[model samples]
Target: MLHALINGLGLGLLLAIAVGPIIFSIIKISLGYGKKAGYAFITGVCLCDALLILLGNVAAEVMRSALEYKNLIGIIGGCLFIIMGIYSFFFGKKPDFEKSRDIQVDYRKRDMAKFTLQGFFINLFNPGPLLFWLTTCTTYSFLNTNERILLFSTTLAVVFLTDFLKVNLAQKIKRWLTPPNLAKLHKATALILTLCGVIIASSVILKNFISW
Candidate 1:
Protein backbone atom coordinates (compact mmCIF):
# COMPACT_ATOMS: atom_id res chain seq x y z
CA MET A 1 0.00 0.00 0.00
CA LEU A 2 2.77 2.41 0.84
CA HIS A 3 4.48 1.60 -2.42
CA ALA A 4 1.27 2.10 -4.36
CA LEU A 5 0.59 5.39 -2.61
CA ILE A 6 4.08 6.65 -3.35
CA ASN A 7 3.86 5.60 -6.98
CA GLY A 8 0.46 7.21 -7.37
CA LEU A 9 1.75 10.43 -5.83
CA GLY A 10 4.58 10.53 -8.33
CA LEU A 11 2.26 9.89 -11.26
CA GLY A 12 -0.18 12.50 -10.01
CA LEU A 13 2.57 15.08 -9.65
CA LEU A 14 3.97 14.54 -13.12
CA LEU A 15 0.53 14.61 -14.74
CA ALA A 16 -0.34 17.77 -12.84
CA ILE A 17 2.59 19.47 -14.51
CA ALA A 18 1.29 18.76 -17.99
CA VAL A 19 0.46 22.03 -19.80
CA GLY A 20 -2.66 21.53 -21.89
CA PRO A 21 -6.25 22.59 -22.39
CA ILE A 22 -7.12 21.47 -18.88
CA ILE A 23 -4.39 23.66 -17.43
CA PHE A 24 -5.38 26.47 -19.77
CA SER A 25 -8.96 26.10 -18.64
CA ILE A 26 -7.79 26.42 -15.04
CA ILE A 27 -5.88 29.59 -15.89
CA LYS A 28 -8.77 31.09 -17.79
CA ILE A 29 -11.13 30.31 -14.97
CA SER A 30 -8.82 31.91 -12.45
CA LEU A 31 -8.16 35.02 -14.49
CA GLY A 32 -11.69 35.44 -15.71
CA TYR A 33 -13.67 34.43 -12.62
CA GLY A 34 -11.17 34.36 -9.76
CA LYS A 35 -10.33 31.66 -7.23
CA LYS A 36 -13.80 30.21 -6.92
CA ALA A 37 -14.00 29.28 -10.58
CA GLY A 38 -10.43 28.08 -10.48
CA TYR A 39 -11.22 25.77 -7.61
CA ALA A 40 -14.36 24.64 -9.38
CA PHE A 41 -12.31 23.71 -12.42
CA ILE A 42 -9.89 21.75 -10.28
CA THR A 43 -12.72 19.96 -8.54
CA GLY A 44 -14.12 18.97 -11.88
CA VAL A 45 -10.81 17.42 -12.90
CA CYS A 46 -10.60 15.51 -9.64
CA LEU A 47 -14.08 14.18 -10.19
CA CYS A 48 -13.07 13.10 -13.64
CA ASP A 49 -10.10 11.26 -12.18
CA ALA A 50 -12.34 9.56 -9.68
CA LEU A 51 -14.74 8.51 -12.39
CA LEU A 52 -11.95 7.01 -14.45
CA ILE A 53 -10.69 5.13 -11.43
CA LEU A 54 -14.14 3.73 -10.82
CA LEU A 55 -14.60 2.84 -14.44
CA GLY A 56 -11.23 1.14 -14.57
CA ASN A 57 -12.10 -0.92 -11.54
CA VAL A 58 -15.57 -2.00 -12.65
CA ALA A 59 -15.05 -2.14 -16.41
CA ALA A 60 -11.36 -2.82 -16.67
CA GLU A 61 -11.63 -5.28 -19.47
CA VAL A 62 -13.89 -3.07 -21.57
CA MET A 63 -11.71 -0.04 -21.00
CA ARG A 64 -8.60 -2.01 -21.70
CA SER A 65 -9.98 -3.22 -25.02
CA ALA A 66 -11.30 0.19 -25.97
CA LEU A 67 -8.04 1.99 -25.17
CA GLU A 68 -6.03 -0.57 -27.07
CA TYR A 69 -7.62 0.56 -30.31
CA LYS A 70 -4.97 3.24 -30.36
CA ASN A 71 -5.58 4.72 -33.79
CA LEU A 72 -9.30 5.08 -33.28
CA ILE A 73 -8.98 6.81 -29.96
CA GLY A 74 -6.11 8.85 -31.32
CA ILE A 75 -8.13 10.08 -34.28
CA ILE A 76 -10.96 11.15 -32.05
CA GLY A 77 -8.66 12.77 -29.50
CA GLY A 78 -6.63 14.41 -32.25
CA CYS A 79 -9.68 15.87 -33.93
CA LEU A 80 -10.82 17.30 -30.64
CA PHE A 81 -7.37 18.70 -30.01
CA ILE A 82 -6.95 20.22 -33.44
CA ILE A 83 -10.36 21.82 -33.16
CA MET A 84 -9.67 23.17 -29.69
CA GLY A 85 -6.30 24.44 -30.81
CA ILE A 86 -7.83 26.25 -33.77
CA TYR A 87 -10.51 27.75 -31.60
CA SER A 88 -8.04 28.99 -29.02
CA PHE A 89 -5.62 30.03 -31.72
CA PHE A 90 -8.25 32.20 -33.33
CA PHE A 91 -9.93 33.11 -30.07
CA GLY A 92 -9.20 36.80 -30.62
CA LYS A 93 -12.81 37.73 -29.91
CA LYS A 94 -12.55 36.64 -26.30
CA PRO A 95 -11.35 39.12 -23.74
CA ASP A 96 -7.64 39.07 -23.18
CA PHE A 97 -6.71 38.12 -19.63
CA GLU A 98 -4.81 41.33 -18.89
CA LYS A 99 -7.94 43.38 -19.49
CA SER A 100 -10.39 41.03 -17.77
CA ARG A 101 -10.14 42.44 -14.25
CA ASP A 102 -13.28 44.46 -14.76
CA ILE A 103 -15.45 41.83 -16.37
CA GLN A 104 -18.66 41.36 -14.39
CA VAL A 105 -20.30 37.99 -13.85
CA ASP A 106 -23.82 37.81 -12.38
CA TYR A 107 -24.01 34.44 -10.69
CA ARG A 108 -24.34 34.56 -6.92
CA LYS A 109 -21.41 32.24 -6.93
CA ARG A 110 -19.65 30.56 -9.80
CA ASP A 111 -21.56 27.41 -10.65
CA MET A 112 -19.06 24.76 -9.68
CA ALA A 113 -21.44 22.13 -10.96
CA LYS A 114 -21.25 23.56 -14.45
CA PHE A 115 -17.51 23.89 -14.31
CA THR A 116 -17.16 20.36 -13.00
CA LEU A 117 -19.44 18.89 -15.62
CA GLN A 118 -17.71 20.71 -18.45
CA GLY A 119 -14.35 19.61 -17.14
CA PHE A 120 -15.61 16.07 -16.88
CA PHE A 121 -16.78 16.03 -20.49
CA ILE A 122 -13.52 17.48 -21.71
CA ASN A 123 -11.66 14.68 -19.96
CA LEU A 124 -14.05 11.99 -21.14
CA PHE A 125 -13.98 13.08 -24.77
CA ASN A 126 -10.19 13.25 -24.81
CA PRO A 127 -9.80 9.43 -24.44
CA GLY A 128 -6.12 9.50 -23.41
CA PRO A 129 -6.91 10.34 -19.79
CA LEU A 130 -9.01 7.20 -19.40
CA LEU A 131 -6.47 5.21 -21.30
CA PHE A 132 -3.77 6.43 -18.96
CA TRP A 133 -5.62 5.50 -15.81
CA LEU A 134 -6.74 2.13 -17.15
CA THR A 135 -3.20 1.28 -18.15
CA THR A 136 -1.25 2.82 -15.29
CA CYS A 137 -3.59 2.45 -12.34
CA THR A 138 -4.79 -1.11 -12.81
CA THR A 139 -2.09 -2.82 -14.81
CA TYR A 140 0.00 -3.95 -11.86
CA SER A 141 -0.37 -6.27 -8.91
CA PHE A 142 -0.81 -5.29 -5.27
CA LEU A 143 -0.11 -7.29 -2.14
CA ASN A 144 -3.72 -7.20 -1.00
CA THR A 145 -7.17 -5.72 -1.53
CA ASN A 146 -6.65 -3.16 1.25
CA GLU A 147 -3.49 -2.04 -0.47
CA ARG A 148 -5.34 -1.44 -3.72
CA ILE A 149 -7.97 0.71 -2.10
CA LEU A 150 -5.31 2.64 -0.23
CA LEU A 151 -3.50 3.30 -3.48
CA PHE A 152 -6.62 4.63 -5.12
CA SER A 153 -7.28 6.88 -2.17
CA THR A 154 -3.71 8.08 -2.21
CA THR A 155 -3.84 8.72 -5.95
CA LEU A 156 -7.00 10.78 -5.56
CA ALA A 157 -5.49 12.72 -2.68
CA VAL A 158 -2.36 13.45 -4.66
CA VAL A 159 -4.41 14.42 -7.69
CA PHE A 160 -6.51 16.93 -5.75
CA LEU A 161 -3.48 18.50 -4.07
CA THR A 162 -1.24 18.65 -7.12
CA ASP A 163 -3.96 19.96 -9.44
CA PHE A 164 -5.06 22.73 -7.06
CA LEU A 165 -1.48 23.72 -6.41
CA LYS A 166 -0.65 23.89 -10.09
CA VAL A 167 -3.67 26.03 -10.93
CA ASN A 168 -2.89 28.49 -8.16
CA LEU A 169 0.81 28.56 -8.88
CA ALA A 170 0.29 29.17 -12.58
CA GLN A 171 -2.04 32.06 -11.91
CA LYS A 172 0.43 33.49 -9.38
CA ILE A 173 3.20 33.29 -11.94
CA LYS A 174 0.98 34.90 -14.58
CA ARG A 175 1.61 38.31 -13.06
CA TRP A 176 5.32 38.18 -13.77
CA LEU A 177 5.01 37.22 -17.42
CA THR A 178 4.30 39.64 -20.26
CA PRO A 179 1.32 39.32 -22.59
CA PRO A 180 3.43 37.99 -25.45
CA ASN A 181 5.02 35.44 -23.16
CA LEU A 182 1.63 34.30 -21.98
CA ALA A 183 0.31 34.05 -25.50
CA LYS A 184 3.30 31.97 -26.43
CA LEU A 185 2.69 29.74 -23.48
CA HIS A 186 -0.92 29.19 -24.47
CA LYS A 187 0.10 28.35 -28.03
CA ALA A 188 2.80 26.03 -26.80
CA THR A 189 0.34 24.26 -24.55
CA ALA A 190 -2.04 23.78 -27.45
CA LEU A 191 0.73 22.31 -29.56
CA ILE A 192 1.80 19.88 -26.88
CA LEU A 193 -1.75 18.70 -26.31
CA THR A 194 -2.25 18.24 -30.01
CA LEU A 195 0.94 16.26 -30.11
CA CYS A 196 -0.22 13.98 -27.35
CA GLY A 197 -3.40 13.28 -29.23
CA VAL A 198 -1.42 12.52 -32.34
CA ILE A 199 0.99 10.24 -30.55
CA ILE A 200 -1.84 8.23 -29.07
CA ALA A 201 -3.39 7.94 -32.49
CA SER A 202 -0.16 6.90 -34.17
CA SER A 203 0.78 4.42 -31.52
CA VAL A 204 -2.59 2.72 -31.57
CA ILE A 205 -2.79 2.71 -35.35
CA LEU A 206 0.64 1.16 -35.62
CA LYS A 207 -0.13 -1.41 -33.00
CA ASN A 208 -3.49 -2.25 -34.50
CA PHE A 209 -2.16 -3.25 -37.85
CA ILE A 210 1.29 -2.19 -38.95
CA SER A 211 3.79 -3.69 -36.56
CA TRP A 212 5.63 -6.75 -37.86
Candidate 2:
Protein backbone atom coordinates (compact mmCIF):
# COMPACT_ATOMS: atom_id res chain seq x y z
CA MET A 1 0.00 0.00 0.00
CA LEU A 2 2.75 2.36 0.97
CA HIS A 3 4.73 1.51 -2.11
CA ALA A 4 1.68 2.04 -4.28
CA LEU A 5 1.00 5.37 -2.61
CA ILE A 6 4.51 6.56 -3.25
CA ASN A 7 4.51 5.38 -6.84
CA GLY A 8 1.14 6.99 -7.49
CA LEU A 9 2.24 10.24 -5.91
CA GLY A 10 5.31 10.39 -8.11
CA LEU A 11 3.37 9.60 -11.28
CA GLY A 12 0.62 12.05 -10.43
CA LEU A 13 3.10 14.83 -9.83
CA LEU A 14 4.76 14.06 -13.12
CA LEU A 15 1.47 14.27 -14.98
CA ALA A 16 0.50 17.46 -13.21
CA ILE A 17 3.80 19.10 -14.02
CA ALA A 18 3.99 17.86 -17.58
CA VAL A 19 3.88 20.73 -20.03
CA GLY A 20 0.85 20.00 -22.12
CA PRO A 21 -2.05 21.74 -23.81
CA ILE A 22 -4.36 20.70 -21.04
CA ILE A 23 -2.44 22.70 -18.47
CA PHE A 24 -2.43 25.76 -20.68
CA SER A 25 -6.06 25.29 -21.52
CA ILE A 26 -6.88 25.18 -17.87
CA ILE A 27 -5.17 28.46 -17.29
CA LYS A 28 -6.68 30.04 -20.34
CA ILE A 29 -10.18 29.02 -19.44
CA SER A 30 -9.75 30.21 -15.91
CA LEU A 31 -8.48 33.54 -17.04
CA GLY A 32 -11.10 33.95 -19.74
CA TYR A 33 -14.20 32.38 -18.26
CA GLY A 34 -13.47 32.19 -14.58
CA LYS A 35 -13.21 29.36 -12.05
CA LYS A 36 -16.43 27.57 -12.92
CA ALA A 37 -15.32 27.12 -16.48
CA GLY A 38 -11.92 25.98 -15.39
CA TYR A 39 -13.44 23.50 -12.98
CA ALA A 40 -15.67 22.03 -15.65
CA PHE A 41 -12.78 21.69 -18.05
CA ILE A 42 -10.55 19.94 -15.54
CA THR A 43 -13.37 17.62 -14.55
CA GLY A 44 -13.56 16.49 -18.14
CA VAL A 45 -9.83 16.02 -18.30
CA CYS A 46 -9.86 13.94 -15.16
CA LEU A 47 -12.65 11.76 -16.47
CA CYS A 48 -10.74 11.14 -19.66
CA ASP A 49 -7.62 10.21 -17.74
CA ALA A 50 -9.58 7.85 -15.53
CA LEU A 51 -11.13 6.20 -18.53
CA LEU A 52 -7.72 5.82 -20.16
CA ILE A 53 -6.34 4.22 -17.04
CA LEU A 54 -9.19 1.75 -17.06
CA LEU A 55 -8.61 0.93 -20.69
CA GLY A 56 -4.89 0.57 -20.12
CA ASN A 57 -5.52 -1.92 -17.36
CA VAL A 58 -7.90 -3.92 -19.49
CA ALA A 59 -5.37 -4.04 -22.31
CA ALA A 60 -2.43 -4.63 -20.07
CA GLU A 61 -0.99 -7.34 -22.28
CA VAL A 62 -0.93 -5.12 -25.34
CA MET A 63 0.42 -2.24 -23.35
CA ARG A 64 3.09 -4.48 -21.89
CA SER A 65 4.19 -5.36 -25.40
CA ALA A 66 4.17 -1.68 -26.21
CA LEU A 67 6.51 -1.07 -23.32
CA GLU A 68 9.27 -2.62 -25.38
CA TYR A 69 9.29 0.69 -27.21
CA LYS A 70 8.79 2.94 -24.19
CA ASN A 71 12.25 4.40 -24.53
CA LEU A 72 11.53 5.57 -28.05
CA ILE A 73 8.10 6.87 -27.17
CA GLY A 74 9.37 8.70 -24.12
CA ILE A 75 12.09 10.40 -26.11
CA ILE A 76 9.68 11.41 -28.82
CA GLY A 77 7.08 12.73 -26.40
CA GLY A 78 9.71 14.58 -24.46
CA CYS A 79 11.09 16.20 -27.60
CA LEU A 80 7.63 17.26 -28.69
CA PHE A 81 7.03 18.97 -25.37
CA ILE A 82 10.38 20.69 -25.60
CA ILE A 83 9.57 21.99 -29.03
CA MET A 84 6.17 23.24 -27.92
CA GLY A 85 7.77 24.91 -24.94
CA ILE A 86 10.28 26.69 -27.14
CA TYR A 87 7.58 27.86 -29.50
CA SER A 88 5.37 29.10 -26.69
CA PHE A 89 8.26 30.91 -25.05
CA PHE A 90 9.24 32.72 -28.21
CA PHE A 91 5.85 33.36 -29.77
CA GLY A 92 3.34 33.37 -26.94
CA LYS A 93 1.08 36.36 -26.87
CA LYS A 94 -0.23 38.27 -23.89
CA PRO A 95 -3.73 37.63 -22.61
CA ASP A 96 -6.38 39.67 -24.39
CA PHE A 97 -8.85 40.75 -21.78
CA GLU A 98 -11.13 42.10 -24.46
CA LYS A 99 -12.84 38.72 -24.76
CA SER A 100 -12.70 37.92 -21.08
CA ARG A 101 -15.03 40.60 -19.78
CA ASP A 102 -18.51 39.94 -18.37
CA ILE A 103 -17.64 36.28 -17.93
CA GLN A 104 -20.25 35.62 -15.27
CA VAL A 105 -23.13 36.99 -17.27
CA ASP A 106 -22.34 34.94 -20.35
CA TYR A 107 -21.37 31.70 -18.68
CA ARG A 108 -24.17 29.19 -18.26
CA LYS A 109 -24.70 25.51 -17.51
CA ARG A 110 -24.68 24.74 -21.20
CA ASP A 111 -21.43 26.55 -21.51
CA MET A 112 -20.09 24.55 -18.65
CA ALA A 113 -21.09 21.38 -20.40
CA LYS A 114 -19.53 22.68 -23.57
CA PHE A 115 -16.29 23.38 -21.79
CA THR A 116 -16.45 19.93 -20.23
CA LEU A 117 -16.75 18.28 -23.59
CA GLN A 118 -14.04 20.49 -24.95
CA GLY A 119 -11.76 19.49 -22.15
CA PHE A 120 -12.60 15.81 -22.61
CA PHE A 121 -11.79 15.90 -26.28
CA ILE A 122 -8.66 17.91 -25.72
CA ASN A 123 -7.37 15.24 -23.37
CA LEU A 124 -8.73 12.38 -25.41
CA PHE A 125 -6.95 13.47 -28.57
CA ASN A 126 -3.67 13.96 -26.81
CA PRO A 127 -1.53 10.85 -27.19
CA GLY A 128 0.58 11.75 -24.19
CA PRO A 129 -1.90 10.65 -21.52
CA LEU A 130 -2.68 7.41 -23.32
CA LEU A 131 0.95 6.44 -23.59
CA PHE A 132 1.53 7.57 -20.05
CA TRP A 133 -1.27 5.40 -18.71
CA LEU A 134 -0.12 2.46 -20.80
CA THR A 135 3.41 2.72 -19.50
CA THR A 136 2.26 3.17 -15.93
CA CYS A 137 -0.18 0.28 -16.08
CA THR A 138 2.38 -2.04 -17.59
CA THR A 139 5.02 -1.06 -15.07
CA TYR A 140 2.70 -1.64 -12.13
CA SER A 141 1.14 -4.85 -13.34
CA PHE A 142 2.67 -6.73 -10.45
CA LEU A 143 0.30 -5.09 -8.03
CA ASN A 144 -2.88 -6.93 -7.18
CA THR A 145 -6.18 -5.51 -8.37
CA ASN A 146 -6.88 -3.76 -5.10
CA GLU A 147 -3.42 -2.33 -4.90
CA ARG A 148 -3.69 -1.12 -8.45
CA ILE A 149 -6.93 0.63 -7.57
CA LEU A 150 -5.34 2.30 -4.61
CA LEU A 151 -2.36 3.35 -6.67
CA PHE A 152 -4.40 4.88 -9.41
CA SER A 153 -6.81 6.48 -7.00
CA THR A 154 -3.95 8.16 -5.27
CA THR A 155 -2.60 9.30 -8.58
CA LEU A 156 -5.96 10.77 -9.58
CA ALA A 157 -6.32 12.56 -6.26
CA VAL A 158 -2.95 14.18 -6.66
CA VAL A 159 -3.63 15.11 -10.25
CA PHE A 160 -6.97 16.73 -9.38
CA LEU A 161 -5.46 18.58 -6.46
CA THR A 162 -2.68 20.02 -8.54
CA ASP A 163 -5.09 21.08 -11.25
CA PHE A 164 -7.29 22.71 -8.66
CA LEU A 165 -4.32 24.65 -7.43
CA LYS A 166 -3.57 25.77 -10.98
CA VAL A 167 -7.11 27.07 -11.41
CA ASN A 168 -6.94 29.03 -8.18
CA LEU A 169 -3.54 30.41 -8.97
CA ALA A 170 -4.61 31.50 -12.43
CA GLN A 171 -7.65 33.27 -11.02
CA LYS A 172 -5.59 35.08 -8.43
CA ILE A 173 -3.11 36.28 -11.03
CA LYS A 174 -5.72 37.71 -13.37
CA ARG A 175 -5.17 41.23 -12.07
CA TRP A 176 -1.48 41.07 -12.91
CA LEU A 177 -1.50 39.86 -16.47
CA THR A 178 0.65 42.72 -17.64
CA PRO A 179 2.63 42.16 -20.82
CA PRO A 180 5.91 41.69 -18.94
CA ASN A 181 4.35 39.30 -16.47
CA LEU A 182 2.73 37.30 -19.25
CA ALA A 183 6.10 37.02 -20.94
CA LYS A 184 7.60 35.70 -17.73
CA LEU A 185 4.81 33.17 -17.44
CA HIS A 186 5.46 31.99 -20.96
CA LYS A 187 9.16 31.69 -20.29
CA ALA A 188 8.55 29.77 -17.12
CA THR A 189 6.27 27.32 -18.90
CA ALA A 190 8.88 26.87 -21.59
CA LEU A 191 11.55 26.12 -19.03
CA ILE A 192 9.38 23.55 -17.33
CA LEU A 193 8.59 21.85 -20.63
CA THR A 194 12.24 21.73 -21.60
CA LEU A 195 13.21 20.38 -18.20
CA CYS A 196 10.49 17.73 -18.31
CA GLY A 197 11.64 16.71 -21.75
CA VAL A 198 15.18 16.25 -20.56
CA ILE A 199 14.04 14.20 -17.60
CA ILE A 200 11.84 11.94 -19.71
CA ALA A 201 14.45 11.33 -22.36
CA SER A 202 17.22 10.82 -19.83
CA SER A 203 15.18 8.39 -17.79
CA VAL A 204 14.54 6.23 -20.82
CA ILE A 205 18.15 6.37 -21.93
CA LEU A 206 19.33 5.40 -18.49
CA LYS A 207 16.90 2.51 -18.30
CA ASN A 208 18.06 1.18 -21.64
CA PHE A 209 21.76 1.28 -20.84
CA ILE A 210 22.08 1.14 -17.07
CA SER A 211 20.51 -2.27 -16.51
CA TRP A 212 18.33 -0.89 -13.74
Residues 78-154, model 2: lDDT tens digits: 67656756766677554454443322335675668888887788899987688667656765654668889999999
lDDT of 1 by residue, 118-185 (tens): 66777777665776666544443212456657777777787788767756776665664566766676
> lDDT, candidate 1, residue 172?
69
Q: How close is every model to the real structure, measured as TM-score?
A: 0.58, 0.63
Q: Top model by TM-score, which number?
A: 2
Let me know the TM-score candidate 2 reaches against the reference structure.
0.63
lDDT for model 1, on a 0 to 1 scale? 0.61
Each model's lDDT:
0.61, 0.73
Output the lDDT of residue 165, model 1. Answer: 72
RMSD after CA superposition, every candidate:
7.9, 5.6
Off by over 4 Å in 1: 60-110, 141-143, 175-212
Give the number of colliding residue pairs in candidate 1.
1
| Pairs clashing within candidate 2 | none
